[model samples]
Target chain A: EDQVTQSPEALRLQEGESSSLNCSYTVSGLRGLFWYRQDPGKGPEFLFTLYSAGEEKEKERLKATLTKKESFLHITAPKPEDSATYLCAVQPGQGAQKLVFGQGTRLTINP
Target chain B: GAGVSQTPSNKVTEKGKYVELRCDPISGHTALYWYRQSLGQGPEFLIYFQGTGAADDSGLPNDRFFAVRPEGSVSTLKIQRTERGDSAVYLCASRMNSNTGELFFGEGSRLTVL
Candidate 1:
């Protein structure tokens, strides 16, 4: 079974604090790693997609990096508006479009 | 709209009743997906559609759950004999094509089984 585990189920950070959320996975084959941000009572918003090990992508204050076994979402100088549940999902190879997602890490940036 | 759209922002139904959730994917998007999300958990895949055909449905839990995308633009998910366990947010997402990995999601429909 393809499984994803995210650590630190919830994290509280001060404004401008920098930290990283972890997403570890064991998949049959890695196709793409995705990051999404969801707010309360709303759907998830696409953030980034990392396709290979040693690949990194960034947008604004967020940076996503992927490895052979895991992915990391680094938040730099986060603000209150950045507070949301960050989700990690993987699309396994072999022509599969379904994504296996981790439980997600709820991040709160307190100003 | 430019993004995916879902109907019935909230729905409350009694157990054993039938329910249907609708999804309207973005224009020109050929790949559509349905996922269920519970509190404190990520979205769980239910089905996927490519054009008017169901490309994958391995994630559907049981026979009671069924979906159709006849026109290939609007889709509906029907649940028969709904149970309390079925209460959750139903999310619909769409991709431009199989070549792209990012899925644009909607606000989701919150289902409450009473």
Candidate 2:
């Protein structure tokens, strides 16, 4: 069975603090790994897509890295505006465009 | 360009009532998808429409749920005889193509069953 699990379900950090969120997956064939940021009362916003192991992408203060079995979302000098739930999804095999997503990491950056 | 948008940001209905949720994807997006997200969980795939045809409906929970994208642009999700278990946020996303891999999502329509 294909599954994606995110760790530290929730995290609280002070402003300017840095941290990393983890997403582990088990799938047949990895097509791509994606990261998204979702704010309260709003839809998810696309962050990055990593297509292969050793691939990395960055936007603003967030960086996403991928490996064979997992992905990591690293936040640097995060601010309150960065507080949101971070989601990681994976596309497996060659089926439809269905994406299996992790539970998400609820991040709160306190100022 | 504007992002995906869902109608009736929130809906409250009694169990067994029928409800319709609308989703407007970004213009020119060829792939549309529907997903359901329960509290504290990630979105689960429900269906995917490539153009006017449903390329995949395997994730749909049962016959009570149906989705349609008539002109390959806007899509609607219909739920018949809704149960409390069906109460959740329905998300709509659109991508340029299946292989593009980047999905732009809508604010979602929140459904509450009483």
Candidate 3:
């Protein structure tokens, strides 16, 4: 089965702290990996997509990178508004259009 | 609206009642998806639709769950004989038919079965 696992189920960081959330996957083919941020009582918002190992993408205070077996979402100088559950999902190369998601990492940035 | 939209921000129903959740995809998005999210867990895929046909419905747990996208622009998920276990936030997402692989999600509908 294609599986995605995220580490550090819950993380607490001081404002302006920097840290990274990890998402490891075991899949037959690597198509694209996605990162999203979800707030309480709301749906997830898309962040970035990593398609290959050694590929990295950045937006504002968030950066996402992918490896052969895993992906990382790095937050630099996070603020209270950045507090949310970060989700990672993997889409295989078969054009299935279905995503296998990890149990998200709930991040809290304290001011 | 420019983003995906779901109706009835909150729904409360009895255990045996039937319920339907609606989703309006962003204009021109041909791929629509439905997912269920429980507390402390990731979203679980329920179904996927490309145009008016269902591309995948394998994630549905039982026969009581059904969905339709007759017109291809909006979709509805129907659940019969709802159980307390069915309570969760139902999310809807849509993406362009092209291979950008980016999904835009809505503010999910919270369902509570009593």
Candidate 4:
């Protein structure tokens, strides 16, 4: 079975604090790794997609990096507006469009 | 529409009743997906459609859960004999292409089975 595990189920950070969320996975063959940010009462917003080890993508204060067995979403100088649940999902090569998601890490940035 | 849209933002029904949730994908998007999310958990894939055909429905929990996308642009998820365990947020997403790996999601429909 393809499984994804995210650590630090919940994290509280001061405004401008930096931290990284972890997503570890075990799959037959990883086709893609995805990161998303979801606010309360709203759908998840797409953040980044990492397809290969050593790949990294960034947008604004967020940076996502991938390794052979895990991925990290680094939040730099986060603000209160960045507080949200960060989700991680993995798609196996065999499963065309299926995504196995982690429980997610709820991040709170207190100003 | 500019983004994926789902109807019936919130629905509350008695157990054993039937319910239908709808999703409208973005214009020109050929791949549509359905997922269910519980509190404090990530979205779980339920089905996937490419055009008018269901390419994958393996994630569906059981036969009581059925989804259709006849016209390819709009889709409906029907749940028979709704149970309290079925209460969750049903999310719909779309991608311009299957290989893109990036999916745009709708606001989601919250279902409460009483």
Candidate 2 ranges with C-alpha deviation above 4 Å: none
Give each candidate's fraction of reference contacts reproduced.
Answer: 0.84, 0.87, 0.71, 0.80
**Every model's TM-score:** 0.98, 0.97, 0.98, 0.97
Local accuracy by lDDT, each model: 0.95, 0.92, 0.93, 0.95
Better of 2 and 4 by DockQ: 2
User: Tens digit of lDDT per residue, candidate 4, span B10-49?
Assistant: 9999999999999999999999999999999999999999
Per-residue C-alpha lDDT of model 3 across residues A15-102, encoded as one tens digit per residue = 9999999999998787899999999999999999999999999999999999999999999999999999999998877666788899
Give per-residue CA lDDT, model 3, range B5-81, as digits (tens): 99988999999999999999999999999999999999999999999999999999999999999999999999999
Which regions in candidate 3 have their CA more than 4 angstroms from the true location? Answer: none
Show pairs that collide, candidate 1: none
Which segments of candidate 1 are over 4 A away from where they belong? none
Candidate 3 chain A: minimum summed lDDT over ten consecutive residues — where?
A91-100
CAPRI rating of model 1 = high
Ranking by lDDT, best first? 1, 4, 3, 2
**Candidate 3, residue B64: lDDT:** 90
Q: DockQ values for all predictions?
A: 0.83, 0.84, 0.74, 0.81
Q: Summarize candidate 2's per-residue lDDT along A21-92 as a digit string, tens digits.
A: 999999989888889999887788989999999998989999999999999999999999999999999989
lDDT for B17 in candidate 4 is 98
In angstroms, the error of model 3 at B25 is: 0.3
